[model samples]
Each structure stands twice: as structure tokens, then as C-alpha cells.
Target: MADIVEVRNKQVIFKDYINGYATGSDMVVTSDATIRLELPKNDDSLILTKNIYLSCDPYMRNRMNRTMEGNYIDSFTPGSPIVGYGVSRVLESSHPKFKKGDLIWGLVGWEEYSLIKDTRTFIKIQVTDVPLSCYTGILGMTGLTAYVGFHEICSPKKGETVFVSSASGAVGQIVGQLAKLFGCYVVGSAGSKAKVDLLKNKFGFDDAFNYKEEQDLNAALKRYFPNGIDMYFDNVGGKMLDEVLRNMRVHGRIAACGMISQYNLDKPQGNYNLLMLIMKRIRMEGFLVFDYYHSYPKFLEMILPLIHEGKITYVEDIVIGLENAPAALIGLFNGTNVGKQVVAITNE
Candidate 1:
């Protein structure tokens, strides 16, 4: 008989349809007993997996509301396991592309082990030089988002003045660093004093500020970029975005990576300074990371070298154990996470 530890699969369940701000209690973790890993007797199309790490993203908020329509991302079903990108180790594989011991990163259930049938979507991890948890953040979707949003969307130029909101966040951190490497004068806005300090002292942002402390966002932008912002990476939308629009230079570019500010609101807020885009000849565009999936190889080529040479740095805020996954994810909305939020399961 195979020795099997009682797998208490803890899943974050959606309480109900959300209207206003989301609370940690909105999600409940239900523990269930799971059987030991077992290979399919006849099916050669399924792969049993043990999730090692789970990614906590801001976008998951969209899935909470059932009434919201036209959202390209799928909503999490009530009374079922919440799904997101995860780094997992294959325990039993029947797919040709994956083997029994392969480490992969892709969409997986919140529980301990998942029987995934769609192996095509999963990317097999060939590189082990970096930490496995990074697959959930910098080395994965977050990195890809920063790369495509910066290089492809913003189309930054040297000596340009760049401003990034949520600058210490998963995507924002990389975006600011990339802008710096491109020889742009970069400034960042973070939620906390600690995050602002990390942006200036650690992440090498030329200047950074705590958005919470700024009474007038327009004045804050003027203080950072006196000449005018040539590129704006809009991570937190609403007031910050409106201020950036007001201060953008002619032909400026804005890459709308995320709108963290509006995620918790029942009704989306409108920017008062919409006319500024016309006056400044600014180009604002929203992008999804999956849109640039074909260019991922090109992105990896550009970023991997920077990582190896120590030209780029990544910071992750890891919460231990699958049991804490719900709290880790809920913390993102409150700006509790300092960097890329990830749940480290098993610590291996």
C-alpha cells in the first residue's frame, strides 16, 4: 500500500455576489479530505498535480461580481474552487509533453492537488536557476505583462520622463525598472511609505511618492516631472490616472496595465480630466497579458539576461502554506502585500 498523508484540500469559496468593497470574510476556506495521487487506469489525457505556489492578482476581483458582463476573464463559480495561475509539480502525467516529475506553471485549482486535463495551456518549466515561486510572479504572467506593456504598448524612448503608479507592485516594479534600463527618467507612486522607499532606494526609481499622502495628485506629478510625463504606466486608475492625463506631454503613451483603485468600487468612477488626452495628444490603451502571448519568447530573451546579470531585481511577498492562501489573496485589495503576492506551499 502506498503511504498517503491526509490531503486536507483547503479551497477559497466565493461567499456570494459582491457589490461594494470586498472583505476577507467574503471568501471562506473549506477543508476537504483528498485521496492520495493515483494514475488513471485507462485515460492517458489527464495529469495529476500538486500545487506548489499560487499567484495572488488584482484582476481576480472582476470574478467576484456575477452581474458584470463582457469581462473576458471568466468568473469563479460559487461553491467551487477558485482558479488562478499556479506553479505545480506533476505527480502523475499521461500527456506526452509532460512527465511524472515535470515542474510546470499554468491555471490550476486552489486545492492541494488538481487533475488537469488541459495540458496545452500549461507551460513546462525548463529553467531551475531561479526560484520556483517566481513562476507565479516575475518570471511568469507579471513579467510578460510588464514587457509587452512597456516595449510593445508604450513604445518608450530614451531620455523620456516615465511615471508608474502602483510602482512597487508585481507589474509596476518591472515596468519602472525596464523604463530605467531604457534610459528614461522614471518616477513611481506606491500606496505606502515603505513601498515608496523600496521604489526609490531598492528598485532604482529616480523618484517615488506615497499616493496616500498626496493631497493633490496633479501637484505630485508636477513635483516629480516638471517638464511633463512622456510615458505613464497606469496601474491604479481613477484620480491618479486623471492627474497623469493632465500632466502628459504631447504624443505621450499610457499603458493601462490595471485599475486597482476601481476594483473594489460598486460603480466605476470616471476621470474628470478626459479632455487632457485630447489637449496633450496622449494615447491611452488597455492591454491584457495574453494578447502578447506570441511575443513571450522575445520578452524572455530581453528580461532573462537582465535577471542573470543582476541588472534587474524582483521582490516577492510570500505567505506560507495552502491554508493561508485565502488571506494572502484577500490582502491584495487592502494593499497589504508589499510586492508580488504568492502563497508558498510545502516550502520546497
Candidate 2:
């Protein structure tokens, strides 16, 4: 190899601990950041890669906080580069499973280049016909979330009445479609009219509505699920969860995934309709994708065929360049994206 050299790396740096919603102010992109062209030392399992696409997930907002007690992942260090799930191409590797030019998906930094220290989370990209950026959402963690939450946790049945909140999102879109494939009558609620269209048209939901237009959430649920819902895949919590509880059929099951509604809330509101759970004998469970990562290969086996046959479709709202990362992340909460919001740092 040539003599080691430092290269200027364009990076999005986390500036401080955030409270409430994460704003663009919390992060700053600097074009002058530098990284060595070679690995530092003796890290045989580590892989050096160039990031291609980065995911902007709601769960990542929790990682921007300073607390460690209630959060699932450790807080991002202030003044350091923030990291999340991403797709990258390995440029140099000491790991036996990877080599130069191998594309992989895993946890990576919000920089042009990253020295990925852990190999445990890494998954070599085995398929490429689909958009490479898709690995950041569907075909990656988001797809796994829907598979485990709906099929495993919720245990959907044929002819069951299902509902999905935040239905136009990465996981929500897939979850709704899976419910339909399972022979369930599915309804989904989104924040905007465009998302409502995407849910009903692209993802093939039985019914979809813009939640913002509903003055009474309970009434909206009643209109869609007149017979009451059998299964609910919850992405946004807070009022949506409470309203869903009020409309669930007896023996209903709820798979609680991410609570994007309460992600930025410092003092989260309690659900008043929770008593309906006891009355209806409903089962509500919260799940993390990490718990079902072992089944990822199986998930790929199941979805790849559906994708190939055009039985399933995924929508992505991708923004180009690492400099625009902050706006793309903040836009998730603002209803600015049609489907999954992904930042394309590079295509290589």
C-alpha cells in the first residue's frame, strides 16, 4: 500500500445533547474533517468502508440525548460524528468475511468514509437488482421490523382486520402490505393526503386516511374499522395508540414498534384508553428488531421472491449528499417525505 495519508472527509457532526425534537441546529456538516487513508493498527476484524446511503430513523432521535437510563442505545457523543444504519462499500478490510469492493449494510457513521469497528452488525449485500439504497430501509432493518412485529409478535390471521399507524413509512408500508398478503383487511393512517394516496395506491391498503384531517381519531377509526380492528401495528404512539385501543375488537393483538409520536416528547402523555385493553382482553407487545436479527436470512428468503414478482413495493424519499443530512432527518417529523427518508452520501 502507498504511504498513509489523511484525506478531507465531509461529515455531519453532532454538536450537543438534544431535548424535544432533533433540529438541523443540533448537527453541522463540515467539509474539512479528515481521516487517515489506512487503518490505525492491529484491528483485524474491522472494515474500512465508503458510505453510500444512510438511514434517517425515528429511533435515532433517542440516541441524540444525554441519558443512558431509559434509552436502548448509548447517547451520541457530542462533537463526534453521529452514526446510524447505512449501506457502504468496503474499501479495505482485515475481516475474513469481507474484502475490497464488497457492499455491506450495518451501523455506520454520517461521514463519507467510516472505520467500522464491529463486524457483528454487518450483513454482506447478497442481492443487487433492487436499488442499493433500499438496503437502508426495506431489505434491511425496517423490513425486519415489519416481519417480526407483524408475523411473529402480532401473529396475524387470515380475514383478520388490521390497522397500521404511520402507514407510509419504511416499516409501516411493509407491515400493511404483509397484512394484506396474509388475507387481512388492512387500513392505514398517515399524516398527509399524499401519504394517504401512497398507502392506498402503492402499498395496496384496503383503506387509508390522513390522520391530520380527523378532528376525532376515535370516529375515524370507527369509520374504517366499523367491525373493530383485530390487529394493530403501531408505529406512532400517543393519541394514535389511545384511539386504537378504544376501537380494537375483543382478543385484538397490538405490535408496538417505534413510538415516533413520543420520540421528541420530554414528558410523554399517558394513554387514557388503556383500560380498554383489560376489557377487550387485548395483547399489546413492544418489540425491538435486534431480538429477531437471527431470522434476517429467513426474512430475506421470504421477501426477495415477493419483490422479484412485484407483489411488494417500497417507496423511498432520498436526498443526495451528506451536507443535506440534517434537513432530511428533521423532515421525517415534518411530514416532508412520501415514504422512507434516506440520505444518499455517495453511490459508490
Best by TM-score: 2
lDDT by residue for model 2 over 109-139, one digit each (tens)?
8999998888888999989999999899889
RMSD (CA, Å), each prediction: 1.6, 1.2
The TM-score values for the models, in the order shown, are 0.96, 0.98
Q: Which regions of candidate 1 are displaced past 4 Å? A: 1-7
Q: What TM-score does candidate 1 get on C-alpha atoms?
A: 0.96
- Indicate the worst ten consecutive residues by lDDT in candidate 1: 1-10
Whole-model Cα lDDT of every candidate shown, in order: 0.87, 0.92
**Clash-forming residue pairs, model 1:** none
Give the per-residue lDDT of model 1 (tens digit) for 71-96.
97877888777789999999988888
